[model samples]
Target: MNIVIIGGGGFLGQKLARALVARGTLNGTAISRITLADVNDPAGIEGASLPVETARCDITDPASVARVVTGETDVIYHLAAVVSAHAEEEFEDGMQINLFGTLNILERCRKLGTAPLMVFTSSIAVYGGEVPDPITETSLLNPQTSYGAQKAAGELLVNDYSRKGYVDGRGVRLPTISIRPGKPNRAASSFMSSILREPLNGQAANCPVGEDFLHYYLSPRKCVENLIRTAEIPAADLGRNRILQMPGRTLSIRQMIDAMSAVAGPEPARLITWQPDEAISSIVAGWRFDIHADRALALGLAADASFEENVRYYIEDDRPGN
Candidate 1:
């Protein structure tokens, strides 16, 4: 089966691409080829087991999106987005890429009429303000940030398009992925990674949120694993409900620091300096991410064992020069 990964230039997309290539199949079918499309050209995978094509795709431009998603495409992993703080800062760019861009992809899938499997990565930022401690399958989406609102809208479109038989869509609301390798991007949640990554690298990191701040997290390894698993789930099981919240480890900023310190010792923790940013804090405060992902668990998707395990995964799998 042919596949496409939009935003394949980014870390998560590239990791997913590598995982797909290494696995050599999806939903029990051997992958014929995978087209990695992004606003910037995705890096080429050296000595790939399958044909990995890299292309420049402007998801905002329907024509550009259409060029990659053809009749032969069997599965589309739509990971493209402007992110949280970036979206909040640049409203038009965010709307164009996050909202209209998703519409463009769905439109292309509709034109195919083949109803290809489309796995859309959503965000837990969809839940905000007042929410249940354990967000259930029935919880309402009241997004406080532009990024969350856009993602919520995307989920609806995916569900509606699936209901219309235009696409076999699966939407998974991802938690804040922590311990991401490399430098932090513009995401308000970037501190989730930076606070751990920089300190472990023996560099100082500024913590914008307080230690008591609560959030849900998942390791990059588990995130990729769950995404693949999401693709394999049967449509019969999902039925009319097209979205599922992926399992995540709920922890506070202090607990996260403690986990890192547990693995790497107090030296890394010492490098973290507390400096609150109201803009970042306000956006994060609106999100109530505590969740019990019953649907995802029943489907055999699993969360990381602990924040400590996540720390080890990063050091071993993604730390610079590891």
Candidate 2:
């Protein structure tokens, strides 16, 4: 099987690449070659049994996106995006990359006519405004942020494109990926990772929301696992709607801090100081932090056992020193 990961330079993308290399197959088919395409060449990948090619391709440029995704490709993992806060601050860039760039990929697959499996990484931000207690598969979308709006739009395209038989598209609405290994980026939920990541690394990180703030979360490990599992799912089973809400744990900020403290000691947890930002709070307040994800669970997707397990996994698999 030949696979292409669009945001391969990013943390989750790189992790998925390494996992694929280690597993050596997808859906029981031996992975012949894997291409990691991004605006910059993906790094830290080496010494794999299979060929792992790195390509520099900008998704916004249709020609560039075309070069990486072709008819010969068996599966495509679309992880590229402008992210939340960045997209909110830069509307034009967000629209260009999040919306148009996605269009470019779908169009390319449509032209291929091979109907390659396209796994799109969407976000929990898609749900907002008068959300139910446990946001389910049947919830109505009312995106409140530019980033949310863009992702919601992408999900619609994925569904429509699949219905049209232009592509075998599967959209997984990802929860806030917490305990991320790297430094913070422009995502409004960056604090979700930073609070734990920085503290564990012996650095201080500010909490942008109060301790009571809640959100759905997934570990980097489970996120990649589900991405691969999504690729393996047969189209016949998906029926008409080609989207699944990826399962995740719902926890408040306090719960996460308590977990961190339990694993890494109170010293690390003490490094987190609450200094709420109104803009960040407002953006996050509208999101549905609790979700049932019945479809994903039924489809064999799973969430992390607990927030504590998430911390431990991060320390073992992606801690800076480790």
Candidate 3:
């Protein structure tokens, strides 16, 4: 099978590419060629176990995205986006990349004449505003942030295209991926990792939310695993909806800090000091805190058992000097 991963340079995107290359197979199907496309060429992917290709393409530009997606591409993993905080700060850039970028990919798939399975990495932000506890697939979306609105819009487009037979698409609504490696970015959730990562290296970190603030989460490994699983699931099983509320563990900010402290030390926890930011708190407050994920669980998509396991996995796999 030939696979194309858009946004392949990003942290999660690179992780998924490495996993696909390491496994060399998916659902008993052999992976023949893997194409990694992003605005910047992916780095540190040398000595891959399988045949790999790279391309620089902007997902926001239809012509540019089409140039790389053409020819025997069996699967497309759409992981490109402007991220949450940046989207909220720069609304126009967020809309252009998060929403229009997805449209460009779907349009390219339609013109291909061959229905390739498109796995879109959506966000939990899609379920915002007045959301019910344990948000289900049936929950109505009322996104308050620009990022959430764009992602929700993308999910709709993916479902509509699937219904129209333009592409075999599945939008997996990802939880807030925790214990991410490396330095933080512009994302509001970047603090989620900084609180753990910075302190481990003897640096200070800030906690923008209250200790009691609740949110749903998953590990980076589990996120990539669920993305691959979504590709393997049968179209008939997904039905007309084409979107899945991914499995995750719901916990508070304090719970996550405690888990990290247990794995690392009290010093790491001490580095995390509470300092609320209204902009971030306002956007995050509207986000869905939990999900049912019955459809995803029944379909064999897996998630991390707890916040503790997620933190431990990060320390072992991506810790500095490991």
Highest-lDDT candidate: 1
Q: Which stretches of candidate 1 lie over 4 Å from their true place?
A: none
Each candidate structure's count of clashing pairs:
0, 0, 0
Q: What number of backbone clashes does candidate 1 have, counting pairs of residues 3 or more apart or in separate chains? A: 0
TM-score of each: 0.96, 0.96, 0.95
Among residues 3 or more apart in sequence or in different chains, the pairs in candidate 3 whose N, CA or C atoms overlap within 3 Å are none
RMSD from true fold, candidate 1 = 1.3
> How do the candidates rank by lDDT, highest first?
1, 2, 3
Local distance difference test, each candidate: 0.92, 0.90, 0.86
Which tens-of-lDDT digit does each residue in 285-311 have in candidate 1? 867767879999999789999999999
Q: In terms of lDDT, which candidate is stronger, 1 or 3?
A: 1
Question: Candidate 2: where is the Cα deviation over 4 Å?
Answer: none
